[model samples]
Target: YEEPLTGEQYRKLELGPAPIDFDNTIQSLETQSKIVKLEVHYHGHPQERFISLDEPDVSLLSARQLEVINETLERLSSMNATQISAFSHQDMPWKATEDKEIIDYELVFYRDPLTSVREYE
Candidate 1:
């Protein structure tokens, strides 16, 4: 038995942030031009894949920075899970904490994105 409200198996726990109560308005992280750097910024649950951008976002980084990013991306893109997964930033087969075996996903970039951010209201 647990405190507060108890359940036999799983309790409807409010583990993370409360749902946003929107009223005739919406907020998004959309960008028009391009993005210099992008990352997976998430808390509570890692579900940032739900955000959709129509087209690719361009990169506005300098030559050296761009080269580094491009080089890293190229190497990483050509990689397969069986090859390596040391540089992963999120949950993956190499970083799994559950009683799992392997990750059932591909780790590669298909193309060069034109953009990576967007906003809505």
Candidate 2:
């Protein structure tokens, strides 16, 4: 490991003062951030589960589509009893489809055509 630079040393090298103090830097580097494990249960069957990098920085569906995708995946995994079987084209948002529709990501779900219902697989 490289030795920690002193304030004078940083200035001599034309580097700005460290953003964080040495102790804080060590903690930040050594300690892993907390992870939230989420599970979605459907009909008493396991569906999906996942580890979140953070609680989730969510609000804008159009801007942060990846987070939405990750959340959807987690939701699918946590379901206890849904059997999603096949993939339908991801629901791409179409202005014609709805007055104000937002289609960011897509995943498959099991649907009974007869009953017209969907379940997680």
Candidate 3:
């Protein structure tokens, strides 16, 4: 996708690229009762799970945007956190960025074949 789903800037963290405002955004959503955060142990490790209390307002997104979101979720749903991080680390946007620096969204256009979303003719 040429355009990002949101305007949030993602930072190149040690694990991978992550949204800088993720924690604050999650806290706000939880406070608003839009979602619930649960602490759960998975494979002897503690993990945070979010359960949505209400359906999303799909009216806010275009059909193409929704399709991209769904496709991305479907592709990633099978992976565990570690696997997802590893997968993200291989992308050019994450690899090219300096540690703790904001990753440029335009780097998506230069992604390697394995991590590329678009097919070239």
Candidate 4:
């Protein structure tokens, strides 16, 4: 997608690029009873899991946005966290940003073919 599906800004971190407000957003959703958060241990590391209490209100998203989101999920679903992080680190947006800095969404336009989702004429 040309634009981000959500307004949340992503930051370049040591692991990869991640939405800065992800934890807060998830907490808010949990508080609102829209979802439930579970803490679990994975390979001796603490991990968080969220379960939705109700269906998401997709009315806010355009058809193209929904399609893009689904396609992205499908593409990444098979990858584990470590692999996904490594993949994201190779993208221009993450590569161009300094550690702890906010990644520029516009950098996506300059992505290399392997990381780019759109075709250029």
- Considering every candidate listed, which one attains the maximal lDDT? 3
Q: Model 2 over residues 1-121: C-alpha lDDT tens digits? A: 0111122111111111122344554455346654433567756675544454666545533433555456566656653221322122122212112322322212112223422223336
- lDDT for 66 (candidate 1): 53
State the lDDT of candidate 4 residue by residue for 8-74, as single tens digits.
Answer: 8999999998899999998899889999889999889999899999988999899888887888888
**Candidate that would win on TM-score:** 3
Q: Point out the higher-scoring one by lDDT: 1 or 2.
A: 2
**Candidate 1 structure quality by residue, lDDT tens digits, 1-121:** 0111111122111221112322111233333322222445455443333334444343444455555557657766775533333334232322332222322222112111322111224
Off by over 4 Å in 2: 1-34, 38-41, 51-84, 88-121
- Each candidate structure's TM-score, on Cα atoms with residue i matched to residue i, is 0.26, 0.20, 0.92, 0.90
Model 1 lDDT, residue 113, Cα = 35
Question: Mind giving the per-residue lDDT tens digits that candidate 3 earns over 1-121?
Answer: 7788887999999888889999999999999999998999999999989999999899999988888788888888999989999999999999999999999999999998778766567
Q: Which stretches of candidate 4 lie over 4 Å from their true place?
A: none
> Which 10-residue window in model 2 sums to the lowest lDDT?
8-17
Candidate 1 residues lying further than 4 Å off, grouped into runs, are: 1-59, 81-84, 87-121
lDDT (0-100) at residue 50 of candidate 4?
Answer: 95
The lDDT for every candidate, in the order shown, is 0.31, 0.34, 0.90, 0.88
